[model samples]
Target chain A: MRLRNGPAASVRYEGILRICAIGLAVFSLLSWLLLGANRGWTKTTRTRWQKDPVTEIEGPLIEKAFLPGVDLLAVGLSGALILFVVSLLVTKNKTNSNQVNSSS
Target chain B: MKNKFVAALGFIALAATAFAAPLEFDFKDPKGVNNVIFKTDAPLESINGTATGISGNVTFDPDNPGAVKGKIVVQSASLHLGNPMQKEHLHSDKWLDVTRYPEITFEVESAKNVKTEGNVTTADVGGKMSLHGATKPITVPVKMTFLKDKLKARTGKEGDLLVIRANFKIRRSDFRINPGQMEDKVSDDIELNLSIAGAAPRG
Candidate 1:
């Protein structure tokens, strides 16, 4: 079976990959901005409690410091980075393949 | 007539001495267990935080729970969020402005509908809540538990302990906290939960 190794096909494929990568990155950036751009780990739980040793009283000791949408930012950015790297690799392969084919 | 008046005064003084005075429980817990949790839920976001710098005094009389009175003060700076940027914004002028208002205070004026069961007493507490440079009258449902001679067990000091728990809601607009702003991300109604244990150590 023959593969689609034409220059135009390769170029079109690379363009699609690049466009998808950029879209992912833009979406991640916008989501992060909207979520307040948390610099720490994301959390969703509403409340936490700590028990006092002396008083033996349990009360809300911590609250959700990271907002709800922060996790979305983290996941989105990570996915965008992966896609961007994949796109870069795809473009590099296409260039290498074209150079070899022209030389042959 | 003079002799009778002297005798009456003596009797009155003896009676007063026999009546126990209300115990002043100090809410400044060295154990750092006293805390106030606040939450506000909106369509776009839910904001929650905890304040641990609590200090105040409440005069509680086990025999008369309805007569409870005191003040609770929370340091405005102690209101904390998990995110540093969000925490800073909360304390900024756009929100609480902690520098301008150094403290959030509640002065208990009266208690009503008090009912005592075992060591716990429940009541409707009326007080003046001062927050964000505004003071407003509010009523909250409070549950107080009097632990006689329990201070020694908790703090290794011979004393009595009073545990107080309350759940209430307040309107941020009432305190002029960025009124009519951020209603979508931050709700106007703020729910507060208070838990504290006050100790009155004895010699």
Candidate 2:
């Protein structure tokens, strides 16, 4: 009795990867929301520029607004999500190949 | 009548001859000026850089020993780390917040001359360091060389910039930056280095 490389295995892998991707996306989004709700970024930008020529020219320059930790988390989670999606696609392709081979 | 007239004339002449002296700096030609460098070390990496803004007067009179005082303010936000991500993190809200508190100011509290070693004049300078909206007292050991029309004081330099250098750690949490998810990723202790140069007055 041969173990089948069929729809069952593909479905399981797909489900797992989807769950992982969703979890990471949710975590990243939640962090962004929580950070905003806490007004953490607000503290850094509270100072207003006076109407001075130097400030007028430089004030519009946008600096890094995300906290280091949050930025890291967001990047890390984004990478993981991308990898998982890629892996899911690869697994689906492999499963299709196996199905074709069995039919032939 | 002739003697009384001469006495009044002599007193007036002596008073008129007195002249106000110009500001004289003992170290007229500072070996170096406007050269100060600060560095930080971390487990993952180390960051080191020099500051461009330095202005102050140093009047050292051995006999009279007049007070020597000055102020140094480094644009905290201008500090550059090798990594752009790290630099951004440093200036972000979780760290230095360079936008809101753009400058790291250090005002000389006191400069006491230590034992003279050859031409080098070592002074312990006490001052307040304001960073991240918090001010803390810091003492910097400064070795100054009096050059013609310049005063060169250095903290750390090895083929990079100067000689005078200091190493101290500052906890980000102490300045009200608490550790949390993203904040916890970075080390609390940060190292600082100060290298400075100033124009020496001409005789």
Q: What is the lDDT of candidate 1?
A: 0.84
Error of 1 at A6 (Å): 13
Positional deviation of B13 in candidate 2, in angstroms?
A: 24
Candidate 1 wrongly placed segments (more than 4 Å): A1-48, A53-56, A59-104, B1-19
- lDDT of prediction 2: 0.51
**lDDT by residue for model 2 (B1-203), tens:** 89989998987876654432223332111232333344545455445444443434444433222244545566766665434555688779767787888777666667665645544567776777777788888777766543322222222221111123234566666676654324334556665654443332332
lDDT of 1 by residue, B75-190 (tens): 99999777566788899999999999999999999998999999899999999999999999999999999999999988789989999999999999999998899999889999
- Give the winner by TM-score: 1
Q: Which stretches of candidate 2 lie over 4 Å from their true place?
A: A1-104, B1-38, B42-50, B56-59, B62-66, B149-167, B177-185
Q: Each prediction's DockQ?
A: 0.24, 0.03
lDDT of 2 at B120: 52
